[model samples]
Target chain A: MSIARFSPFELLLLKSRSQVDTATLLLLAWVLVHRQHVSEGQRRRRLAQVTAQFRHGHELGPIMSIAHSQDLQAIQLAAEVVRKECSNERSLSALYQAITLATDDGDLSLANHYILRFLADLLNIAPSTLSTLFQELTGKPLCPPEDPSRDAYWQQHDPEYHARQAQEAQAAEQQAKEAHARAEQRQRAQTEKQQKKQQKQQQEQQRQQEATRNAKARAQREQAQREHDQHEQARRTRWQQEQARQEEARRRQQHQRSSSPPPADRTTRALAVLGLAPGASRTDVRQAYRRMAQLHHPDRFYSESDHLVALASARFQRIKNAYDYLMQTY
Target chain B: MRDLYQRLALSPSANSHQISSAVTHCANSALRQDAETVLGVAEHRDAYNKLHKTVSDIGQLRARLGLTHGAHWQGDVANDFSLPPDNAISRHDELVDRVSYAVSLYNHWRRFKGPLLLVALFTAGAGIGLAFGFTLGLGLGTR
Candidate 1:
């Protein structure tokens, strides 16, 4: 694996192409450098990291196909196209992204070196420039040490390396602790937020229940009041009806009493018809009748006009009827 | 009959000569006839006097009882003694009653017309929909 450093101009040149072309070129360069040296999983992870870092708007499917391809000619052609189309600065930036993908697992193998060297050569970059860029990105010489006992030489002469390692180990431990503490804090905040939300929901439910209960009670009270009013109105109506009925009865009784005349006996009427007092004798009745009959006799008025004769006849008949009644009673 | 004497302008104790003179002078033929029937005989005169006295007593009693008019009584006495009775129902009253009844009927129809129209429209629409659906279904089935 190797790391490559990019200049600002080289980064800008790399991004200047259409996003799909840049992404395809980047993926092709990555496949060329990492296919031989890295495992498939490591290559995929590094490809993801490089793509994310570049923020390229490319789908993963076509890029994954490029990474899986074993066609060396296609890879070489893609490299040549990138070299011809882009400036040397853009080509270097694309090569640096490929180197970043290869070196993200933290080591530069001989296979990664050969493929990257091949890509640099195809891009028309000099070996020295490649070595210099690799050195700048990884902080090491591009080639391995010549001594076969490389570890022994570093262990004997570079004590600071071991110190730096220990310092890095300590720094990693501190970062892990901080990350754990942050995780616990996030969890605690989340739990508190959930509890507050639950409490709010419970309060809302209680308020809704209270509102429902109040509505129900109010409805019931209103119903009761309405019923009471109806009953009161009904009672009042009945009372008014009763009062009116009694008044009608009293009025009817008064009308009956005032309208009906008192009874009169027929006997008094008959005695009056005979022109006799209540205590008058049969002789008095007869005398009154004879006096009336003689004055009104039809034969005596026969010589007068016919109207006078008719009037005398009716008068004479009444006198005779009264005399007969008096004679029978006496 | 009780007023026969008053009709002839005669006293109860008048002799036949005075009664005949009054009857001959009476202007109304009906009055003359009533006078002749009531006053020509002693018994008839007595009967008229008795009936008159009874009616006068009743009228006095009603006045004491605070009945302002004899018309309040459901009796022939009111008809016989008071002014002519007025007709209870008039053509105008009958027309008013008929118009009011018709107006009430119109109001009832107005009150119910909207709901009735809605119901009729709903029924008609449902019927049309059902017929259309049935015909379409039959055609589809035959096909």
Candidate 2:
């Protein structure tokens, strides 16, 4: 970068006589476009110097043809050839410096901007890297070489065109990230909802099963109670009927005993005194007593002789004695 | 010793009707105060029987003598004992009717014995069957 130590122009003069390759031709064009002279005499002196250098090497015709060409074809062709020869970082840096100086202007031309982009493409340098190189060479901001909204040729020729293509690329990347995040959130929420629904269904099923089991148990208990009550009722009824039968039998036995006759014995002898049979019943004995007492009662013989009443009373007394003995003994 | 006729307040030569009437009168006098007493009535009845037997013996001797004197006995033989009163006979008939009613009731019981036994058996069987059925139903229901 120091003019006193090493100059691009002097370097070109040294390589001029050795070969007239595309690198040597590009160096010459770079010097013609970027170099400044204090006076016309200075410009004339440099031109003479370059011409003499090519004439001494007997390559003046080709060099002069390139210098006098009114198009950027030679510059484009030179850039292609230099791209092959200069692949190292130092050579790329030197080429970047030369392009920067050639394109530098208070107001840049469309032809110069096109030639710069064409050279950078051949050299496989990114447009952004070229901007960084431009800043390094001129200590100023780099102008991007794209603008689709304008006329394609006009944007290339426009000055003060330093816009960023990086913002658009970053925005596309951020949008993709946001879309992916939203999709993941929706998937997670759906999975949680499905799990909750399944859990609720399982709980409902369990409750139903429990309720059914309880109902079955209750029904069973109620049925058992009813049956037990029925069985108890039957048992009570049977017991009551049996009791009634026993009472009936006892009543009949009592009636028979009271009505039946007494056995023949000392009581039977007494019964005979009342004109009853030997094996007479207790009822017969009472009947006999009533009969004899009525017949031989003293009142019956009151009107008759004393002897007759005495006889009736004696007989009645005998009957009464027998009746008493029979009743007491039996 | 006092004679049997004297005990009955009769003369030794009295006829059978006169002797029987006189004996009844004497016995009635002795039994009238305590006729309801068993011991008194028994004692009176025993005395009357003994007197009657002795009087009959005396009468038989007298009858033999009378027969030698050409006297015939003309009294009915049934006149010696008295018949029971009509009310006594009616009481006896009433007793017979009661006994007959009791007999009829017993006969009715005998005639219906088979059906009554069958009813009792059916009741018992039905009770047992109902108990068993209820027990089985309860067991199954509980299970």
Docking class of 2: incorrect
Q: Per-residue lDDT of A221-321 in model 2, one digit per residue for the tens?
A: 78877998999999999999999999999999999987876555766578668887776788978887887799889789764545566667778778878
* Residue-wise C-alpha lDDT for candidate 1, range A205-247, written one tens digit per residue: 9999778767787878778779999999999999999999999
Q: If you assessed candidate 1 against the hidden native complex, which CAPRI class would it receive?
A: incorrect
> What is candidate 2's DockQ?
0.04
Model 1's i-RMS, to one decimal, reads 73.0
TM-score of chain B of each: 0.44, 0.31
Evaluating just chain A, the predictions reach TM-scores of 0.34, 0.30
Residue pairs with backbone atoms closer than 3 Å in model 1 (clashes): A1-A108, A1-A109
> Best by DockQ, which number?
2
Per-prediction TM-score: 0.25, 0.22
Number of clashing pairs per prediction, in order: 2, 13
Worst 10 residues of 1 chain A by lDDT: A145-154
Question: Where is model 1 more than 4 Å wrong at Cα?
Answer: A1-42, A53-57, A144-330, B1-143
